[model samples]
Target: MKPSLRPSLPLLLAAAVMLSLAMGLRQSLGLFMAPATRDLGIAVAEFTFAIAVQNLGWGLLQPFAGAAASRWGFRPVLLAGVLSYLAGLAVMALAQGGFSLLVGAGLLIGIGLACTGSGMALAVAARPVPAALRSSALGIVSAAGSVGALLAAPIGQVLAEGWGWRAGVWGFLLLGLAMIPAAWIAGRVDRVPIPALAPGESPRMAVALGRAMSHTPFLVMAGAYFVCGLQLVFLTTHLPSYLALCEQDPMLSAKALGMIGGFNVLGSLFFGWAGGRWNKGALLGGIYLVRSLVLGLYFAWAPTEASTMVFAAIMGFLWLGVAPLVSGLVVEMFGLRFQAMIQGLAFMSHQFGSFLGAFGGGVLFDLNGDYVLAWKLGVGMGLVAGAVQVAYALRGAAPPAAERPAAA
Candidate 1:
């Protein structure tokens, strides 16, 4: 029997909203770092490490969180995630010392994000959309996250300026609380139940999962995403500070971040559409190449507001575009049997990259007094990732025999 394609509008809307809020808030955390560090009298590295831990935690928890959602359903996981996120925000807000800040920002927020953030949301969203429209749904969800970044940066700056960093954190907590309703609504969408097999089913869930992990194409894609995570998270988390080092105006930093978010919508939509028509892995590989070229040009060219904005826009266009393609590739390779779980597992690699990106940038900058070295490394890795992806695509895929329906 064909699985039903239609899903309730309310469910889609809720997924989009929660996805937006979770992504945007997480992206905006970079804006808080400078001020938070200043107010708490902590080293920039310390805060960077905290944020690194958050990225690591988010990555590490994705597979398990996705599994939990898959097993118990998306609603419970979302609720738990949101509650944990709010508590983390509160912890950061009330923190009077470095240790408190570390616990809240590093550990608590990290785990909270793992549960409530994009990895889990995308999994839920994937369930409702038709197989053909899956890429587009992912684009919409990823774009929502970018929109969050667009809204969060300026708002965070304003709130921090007026009431202070503590108060600003409180604002994030309230917004997180508001997201609970969205999560609840997302849960209301009726799932197309996976019917129990009669006497024999294809393989057990565990066996299928293990097979996917060992799949060559999946591994290659996962590895490429790791590089993407490294570049993107590091840039978003540290770009504002890097701009500050260049002696640019503070508002310029926020505007740059907002510009990245704004342009990312176009990037994501473009790639998502392209993923349907093109060889996804090849398309993704090309994107990484473009990123490398853009970064190299930016570093070589003289720095000016115009140059920075233009570079930001170009980079933004390539930014989250990779997301839909990566997720789509997973569905293509494995079928959506355990999509969220598999995608989450892949995302762990990306998040691990994020951990390196966030913390390594800080460590490198502190040791070298410049971001030059980190930029160079990112360019090189981008090239390597592109090459790796193209190689994976050339290997090709075969249809699963299990996909044929059983005789009555």
Candidate 2:
């Protein structure tokens, strides 16, 4: 294969760095929920709803951003994403009310994620790489975000407490802006393989999405990933509150979260490398299965600082581990032409789940004085998600493209 058959070093680095910055910054948002809300006199439900809005916005906008990237190159769209992210962060730093937080943390941040985070980053990074190396490449990129999380989480908490949550907002804003130089690197190419199409046989993104939606396997996969989002968001958004409820040291939540980020780096890399040697979908199923068990154990034992750290380390290793597999599934079935669009559609499910996780945790905690129900539900969902993936893998058939439409 020629050199162009693979992603260039700079392209991969740029995408990885952007993803790291975006994800790490976004994950740190949870740390601010408690402090910011208390200071602003915002209700937990209201604030959680604001965070949920970000997840919802991210899901809904990802497909559009991806489709736009498919038609235009990734650079302009990515630049737009950069601007949106910076604007959102700026608003957050200055915000003292719910409405401003809604605009900053909810809407603009979601738009930024749609453009610069997983959906577009994965597409740009993988599309330029050879099939065999794509999984490893995707893993490396995903793991980069974990590294960001490792560094950003503790720092975010410190900033939030020290400068008030507003200062933490400023810190994340600066980190998000760092993606600009990376965008310049990743923007150099937006190559998508185009096969010969018969006259009047154009392959539109809508058609691809329609095909994916109509497929049972794809639907099942999406449903499974919804649980993934829910599990993650619940932990990320509400862990601080949960700790406070249990009368544990407040710093412990930050420490656990930071550990999760640190271990997640290892998990992403391991999963990425493992996908090359194992069945991708099967690996995803296994990952979810382990998640269910881990969460069950977490709930079984009383919460302790040491136990929390242990759980975080274990969970972190599995965090975002399925990203490459699930994303790879889309590319495997549909090829690279519709990579961004189809993958975005799939991630939509993840973000929707995230919304439920973040908002639901707050609602449940507010109503019941604890997070027992949320944790139980997450465990059940994880089991279901695992079974769904396994079943889909066993029933593997050709993706909708080769069967009914022009090669995408």
Candidate 3:
């Protein structure tokens, strides 16, 4: 909020380190679903619901988190997030049933992620830097966060195998402690001008929220992002269990996740690079279409070790690349002033999709004893999401004025 506060390399580094720790821990939770559920004497449905709630919390709170950071300070919010996540891990370790799980995993960690994860990282890091170098700075921040993927799954697998899921959780908690200092270092924000409309003019915050809600292009974009959430959460949460059901080698599941993390580095870099040359919306549409095709390939073939690895690589390539495009498109459509709020709404749609995918997958599997139908549903949604993005691309960009809200 201090427009006078300068952005520095230390701030970027702090954001990067915080992101890596927060996301790394969140990504590793899927590996714990089975072990945790069994040990807690809970059904998969209840357990997954807790995680689903976490996603919803993360999405729902994103805008407010950004706003809080803007008004107060990014450091305080980031510090709160670190404490929240640590508390959630501690509670989850001791949780015995649904209530504790929901509160710990669902509420605490979800809000924690809101404060510490990419949304805050981008908003905080981008604010301090000059506009000219902003894009590269954002790119570095994104890459730093993605590195967490490479670390979490494999380490979780190893720790869960060697010690216990609780031990793994504790280890992650210790790791999260590192983020406290990183977030501290990166918490400074350089404030920018706030516009005051003329008499009879609508407030900018009201307009920004309204515009994001009402704009057809943003609506379609949000819908497409929903598919991203659904696909990712389902795979991350259920892939290991799904592999077990298929009687594939147990190690294959972990390896598949590990490969996803590794390959996504390339996917993120390539697609981000490509977005500059290609139409951003078109690239987004293409990524969704590619996901649908990948899902089809996955469903069409019998589950095999090789097939799973291929699926992971292909899917991972498509992973997270949507974010840069989405954020850029937001900038392309509007400017950066209310980017956090607008982008937060878009991300909310994504997390809602995550809620469905994570929670619904569990419910359907519990009822039907398989994920066949769930996978099919995800594919259908993916196709529709692809079409939505394509429609937005073809329609051409609209003026920022077209998206502004009427007076509240």
Scored by lDDT, the top model is: 2
- Which regions in candidate 3 have their CA more than 4 angstroms from the true location? 1-8, 129-136, 191-203, 401-408
lDDT of each: 0.78, 0.83, 0.78
lDDT of 2 at 30: 82
Which regions of candidate 2 deviate over 4 angstroms?
A: 1-7, 191-202, 401-408
Q: What would the per-residue lDDT of candidate 3 be over residues 227-303, giving only the tens digit for each residue?
A: 88998889888888888888887667778877777776677666656665677788899899889889877976679
- The true-versus-predicted C-alpha distance at residue 14 of model 2, in Å, is 0.3
CA shift of 33, model 3, Å: 1.5
User: Which residue pairs in candidate 1 collide?
Assistant: 24-148
* Per-residue lDDT value at 127 in model 3: 61
Best model number under TM-score: 2
Once model 3 is optimally superposed onto the true structure by TM-score, how far is the C-alpha of residue 407 displaced, in angstroms?
23
Q: After the best TM-score superposition of candidate 2, give how far the Cα of residue 327 lies from its true spot, in angstroms.
A: 1.2
Superior candidate under lDDT, 1 versus 2:
2
C-alpha RMSD values across all candidates: 3.0, 2.5, 4.1
Better of 2 and 3 by lDDT: 2
Off by over 4 Å in 1: 1-7, 195-203, 399-408
Each model's backbone clash number: 1, 0, 2
Greater TM-score among 1 and 3 belongs to 1
lDDT of 1 at 260: 87
lDDT of 3 at 105: 84
